[model samples]
Target: MFYAVSAVVLGFLLDLALGDPHWLPHPVRLIGWLIARLEQLIRPVLPKTPRGELLGGILLTLIVVGLSGGVSWCMLHFAAVYLGKLPAYLLEVVMCYQLIAVRSLKAESMRVYRELQKGDLASARIAVSMIVGRDTEKLSPAGVAKAAVETVAENTSDGVAAPLFYLLIGGAPLGFCYKAINTLDSMIGYRNEQYLSFGKFAAKLDDAVNFIPARLCALLMIAAAFFTGLDGPGAFRIWKCDRKNHKSPNSAQTEAACAGALGVQLAGNAFYGGVLFEKPTIGDARRMVIPNDIRLANRLMVVTSLLSLAAFSLMKLLIIFLLH
Candidate 1:
């Protein structure tokens, strides 16, 4: 138990120090490859009928989630049984570090912030484009900042806290399992005409899995805001008032909190695939989003990460003490 908590803590630090090194082979990428191959093999065989699409989608999710979790568990079990405890702990650290995206998320968003700082709208657009799914080519400087802030806010749940929560409850296998589900949703989980039916299962599953973590992360951010000298009460108020403004069941929870904390309005409108989406505005437009908000957003995220780590570790220790 000590080693488990230690590994979780160390993994977070390592991810901060070395955020998603391109050279390191990532399990999410491997799972993505498998998803593409399986979808190709199975999607072609399944009929194009709605019933067939639904059945095929279910089969696809089951195969991906089951095989991914099973394989990861078997690997970890083999390491623990055959290798020494120290080696197993090291493996856990590496796996956990790979799954969490604390530094990478901030790093990518900061790129947009830095570009915005340079007053280079085109470059800022490009940088924000890398982190966001919406169209960035037509975005203004404020639009770029809002997109960066929004990504940092929403992904506080999806990219970091969700994986960490699963790691605390289970371990690397469960963490990576959660990552697989998130990756699936990121890749094929769309509501477009092509994927509306075929991707419904993965999208819905991702929503279900993210439900609790999204809310938890919102509260964490609110607490973080209080500690970091941000607007905590305003965060809570806006969160309660506007958390459901977005169409997604979970994405807006943290975004609303972040918007209120930073005194910025977010999610007004955006283009995706050449179509402009008139999203409901979150939070009152007390102030326009500035480049510094990105820095503030990243600060809030790190504080939340550290607080969650401390909280989860203490809980694990308490459980260990009680069980003994």
Candidate 2:
């Protein structure tokens, strides 16, 4: 129990100090490779029907998640048995560090922010495109900034808090399982004609796993808004009124809180693959979103990450105490 808690704290600090380096071999990337390969193999074998594709997707999900969790657990068990507790704990620390992505998210968004600061609209659009799913070829400066801010807000739940929550509940093995699920969704969970049926299970499972964590992250972000001198009450009000503004059941929670905290409107129609997606706006148009809001959003995200770590750690400790 002590090692589990210690590893999570150390892993978070490690992520903060050294973000993800491109040179490093990330487990998420490996999981993504596994997912892609499985998709190829499964798609060829499955019948070209909705039900057949759905079955293939479900099987792929189970294999990836089970293998991820099983492999991580086995590695830890072997390290403890052969090497020592210290070696096992170190391994867990690295795995946990790999799971959470707050620092990398900030770094990626800041690329857009920096490009915008230089008045380089084209480069800013390119930078924003790297982090978001929307088409960025013709975005205005404000649109670029809004996209950066929105990704930061949405990922405050997806990239940071959700992984931390899973780590608290079941350590790195479970965290890897969560990451596998997320990777599968990001790779194939699209509503496009090609993936509509095949990706249904991945999309639905991602939503199921993220449901509680997303709302919890939003509430924590509201508290972070209060502590950071943002519009805390307004965050709550807008979250209550607009958290369901997105098509996804969970994507809007943090975005609504963030839009309210920054006093701006976000998420009103966007282009993807040259197709227009008419998304409802979340929050009031109290002000136009600016590039500096990217920095502010990063601030809120970091504060929310810290708060979730503390809260989850304490909960794990309480559970351990109760069990004893």
Candidate 3:
């Protein structure tokens, strides 16, 4: 537990000191490649029947879970010994911070803001495209801002809270395993025809694992909003009202609170590959979204993350004291 907590803190500081480097190998990317390779190996052997698909999927899910868990345990154990306790702890902290995308999220959102500030709509559209799945080519400034804010809000839970929750519950090995599963889901767990069956288990497992963490993320965002002097009542109200707007039952809860806290509406008709997805709007639509909203959201995310860390640290200390 000490090593796990230390790694999270150190990893976060390292991320702050050095944003993602292009040259370094990302563990998530490595895990994703492994998942792809395993899927390919299984594909050739499976029969072309629904029953076969179901059986293959169950086997694949078990393989993925076991392999990921085993790998994480080995890596953590090696790190603890080879890296030395203090350095390993620091590395773990940095690793944990890497799991959260708060800084990257802010950077991507700011890129759009910078383009918009220069009055370069074309460039702003392109920049926004990097971060959101929605059609950005036709977005107005408000639309772009809305997209940035909404993405940040939703990912705050997926990219931060969920990982942290797992880390607190089961330490570094479990945390890394969760991140591995999340990476696999992101890479292959699409509803598209190609991945629908192949990635079914990954997607469903990801959803199941994230259920509790997502709600906890919403609560943390609400608390952070109140701490930051935002409209707490409005945040709660909109969160309750729009919690079911998203396709994922959990994502909407956090995004809705963030939208309301920032006093901007989020969601509407979004297009992906020219297909339109009409989603319910969250929060009031009266307030206009601006670049500053991204900054505010980032601020809130940082505060919420810090609070979570403090709470977890205290819990760990209490456990130690009791055990001793």
Best by TM-score: 2
Candidate 1: give the clashing pairs.
none
Off by over 4 Å in 2: none
Q: Quantify all predictions' global Cα lDDT against the true fold.
A: 0.89, 0.94, 0.77
Model 3: per-residue lDDT, tens digit, 39-117? 7888779986656665666677677767777876777678778887766565556556666666777788888888878
Identify the superior model by lDDT, candidate 2 or candidate 3.
2
Question: Model 1: per-residue lDDT, tens digit, 235-317?
Answer: 99999999999878999999999988888898888889999888899999988888999999999998988877877778878
Structural RMSD, model 3 = 2.4
Displacement of residue 134 (Cα, Å) in model 1 is 0.5
Under the 3 Å rule for N, CA and C atoms, how many clashes does model 2 have? 0
| TM-score sort, best first | 2, 1, 3
lDDT of 2 by residue, 1-324 (tens): 877999999999999998999999999989999999999899999999999999999999999999999999999999999999999999999999999898999999999999999999999999998999899999999999999999999999989999999998999999999999988889889998888988999999999999999999999999999999999998999999999999899999999999999999999999999989898999999788899999999999999999999998998999999999
TM-scores for candidates 1 onward, in order: 0.97, 0.99, 0.90
In candidate 2, position 4 carries an lDDT of: 94
Task: Kindly report which residue stretches of model 1 are placed more than 4 angstroms away from their true locations once superposed.
Answer: none
Which parts of model 3 are misplaced by more than 4 Å? Answer: 1-3, 79-84, 319-324
